[model samples]
Target: MTRFDAATADGRRELFADAIRAHDERDSAFLTIEAAGNGANAGNDAGSGSESTPWVQFADGTLNLDCTDDELDRLKSLLDEFPSFTVDDLTTPEDVDGTNVRVVARTDDERVGEFVDRVFQRVYNRPDGYRAWVTVV
Candidate 1:
């Protein structure tokens, strides 16, 4: 678990930004905070027939799929102005196989590490501290 303490807002913001950047690099995707309905969902198709086969589909939820590195850094800085920051108690596995990984970002240290692990699992199928069949991804 990585640990870091922030005594001021600026320090917290910087730490948060650094954490976000690290996460982006590991995940190969950027993070952004956009409006709820301004994003597109990558849907999955369940049939090879025509559009009248009652294809089962579902919304994958909204996300900022096109966030720039600088944008993500800015958001991290903004988030630091809240209260405290820490990124500890994070675990990363060595292998992943397409499963749901849970990211628990409580303090600055834990949040950053967990966020990075989760994003990496989501985008690049990487594993964090402990590998599991259900949360490997």
Candidate 2:
């Protein structure tokens, strides 16, 4: 499949976030999309599951739906129109300049794991790889 990258840093972030929201929207459990903290920012985890928990923050620094999967393929297909959607990164998550959207709704452990994964994905990955991510099925 063809891979797509956002035109600008902000666009890249938003593209990733869109893929996330699209995939997450597949599940009925995902009910809401909220903002979160990052970088030097103090974050606003208002609509969350429990205290001190992590969440699925998207690229562009905002938005990831929750409340939760079958439609994952369908939403992924939508990326075809974007010209930048890639299969690799969608499975994984990235964070640059505090753009990853908050990932709430899941267990605290899962949230934290996801958070760390995003950081590592961007940190370890090369050049624009920072915008790309690697994940397990």
Candidate 3:
């Protein structure tokens, strides 16, 4: 399982932002979060369609979210802090959104390597890691 290393929603969000920002070259960026909310379930059931996936498309500077402006504003505010961490050695995730959010980093305009490639490589080669995925009905 791509471990929920972070405990709370904000923690996860911070982790996500950190992942994107660490590779972020420009000051501005777009954030994308793939989420499947369970209708009125209150997280009582543990299956599909009850998780959220967020991504920061630094290349395009856009945030993929299915929420309101208020939500976006809050996220933007959080990003303004801009925390940093190491993604190269994450416990290796089984997937990104459903498997792994592949993050590639370029050097001087040339593709050097994936920033968070380890997450996939470790699992891709060994096929054993932690990842949480729930398909919405």
Candidate 4:
């Protein structure tokens, strides 16, 4: 299993998306993904929280890829394709215990779960080991 270090917002999103795709494709049950908040930038206040000063927060998740080698490769490939998708308002190098990678997402839409699910299904198909924080939006 490849060790994924999602220290940044973009990296986190990519990692999360990849894990979801891997779960959908291989039907792996051991691997579990969950949204995790380490309080990296939780209450840093970005202006007045208005349109111009949209408060940025860390939306985090973890992917436990305990699957076979094939599954791991598939997950990696999915992550590599994340740049194809458009992700805005994200910060880089989300520090978690002094590690960094880049993981974040804009949560303005109520259908975030649906959107994530759709992205997973559109790219792969298995439906497991992928979760996100709905309140981020």
Candidate 5:
């Protein structure tokens, strides 16, 4: 996990910006994060279509998406739709396989959690190193 202080906005911006830039040069990139707490149902019942449980807490830091070309494109689409995120392409050329975009977080931590939960879901009792294993739902 690339260490970025998720507690601060500047850190998040730098992390996202750097990730976007790094994605330009590499075939894959993943932000690694440490586990912070137990994954518990946050009052949202099963089949509700909305999960209250957070796979990676703010305190748990952030994990890398380990994105592929297609996944990065899909992520860009998701970021475009998400109000709290922006796909910045001013500094970089268009991505070869995807759009050259930087997914910057424009909102607070709580909202970031909500956005991530939309893409990655947590499985209880499954640990990946110090973190609970997360999968696309």
Candidate 6:
């Protein structure tokens, strides 16, 4: 898998353009958009979950979403509105500029895909927004 950073509006445009191209060519895959957080490196301390950082694990969820510190409260509030969704992990990188969150939406079963588009729209529409990349699942 490869990553294309959409840190700017132009970058976002280019990233989507590439995704469209890939889709048009019929090589569709998974895409992830999350907090870039001032380019900070979320390093890990040697511990039980030391193998990978929380953000990485969170991104591996059924529906991946994230936001900056400025939007954390609102994000949490949005999640609260839907009991089917529960925050699995919330990671704040030491000495970093923001937080990364992971949520899982499941009631009787994993009812997630239906909520992704709505959740992602709210996240990326924020003024401080988040980040994104594409992976060939």
Give the distance in Å from residue 51's predicted Cα in candidate 2 to where it truly belongs.
39
lDDT by residue for model 3 (1-137), tens: 13323323444444454545443543334433222223343223323354443322334332222223343344334333333321221122344222222222333211111222222222222122222121210
By TM-score, highest first, what's the ranking? 6, 5, 3, 4, 2, 1
Runs in model 5 deviating more than 4 A are 1-31, 34-65, 89-102, 121-137
Best TM-score among the predictions, by candidate number: 6
Each candidate: what lDDT? 0.29, 0.31, 0.30, 0.33, 0.38, 0.45
Task: Please give each candidate's TM-score.
Answer: 0.21, 0.25, 0.27, 0.26, 0.34, 0.45
lDDT of 2 at 8: 33
lDDT of 4 by residue, 1-137 (tens): 24332333444456545554454466554333333222333223222233221111223432111223343344346545554323332222344222112223333222233334333333323233322221221
Task: Show model 4 residue runs off by greater than 4 Å.
Answer: 34-137
TM-score (C-alpha, index-matched) for candidate 4: 0.26
Q: Please, what are the lDDT tens digits per residue for candidate 2 over residues 1-137?
A: 12333223344355444445454555323322222222222222322333222233333322242211322333334334323323333322343222222322232323333433333223222132223221100
lDDT of 6 by residue, 1-137 (tens): 13454544445445544544444356444433332332233111211232221122122233444457656776777777778778877788787767767676454212342244234345434223334443332
Candidate 3 local lDDT, residue 128: 24
User: Model 6 — TM-score against the truth?
Assistant: 0.45
Residue 61 displacement in candidate 1 (angstroms): 12
- Among all windows of 10 consecutive residues in model 1, the one with the lowest summed lDDT is 53-62
RMSD of each: 17.5, 16.3, 15.0, 17.1, 12.7, 10.3
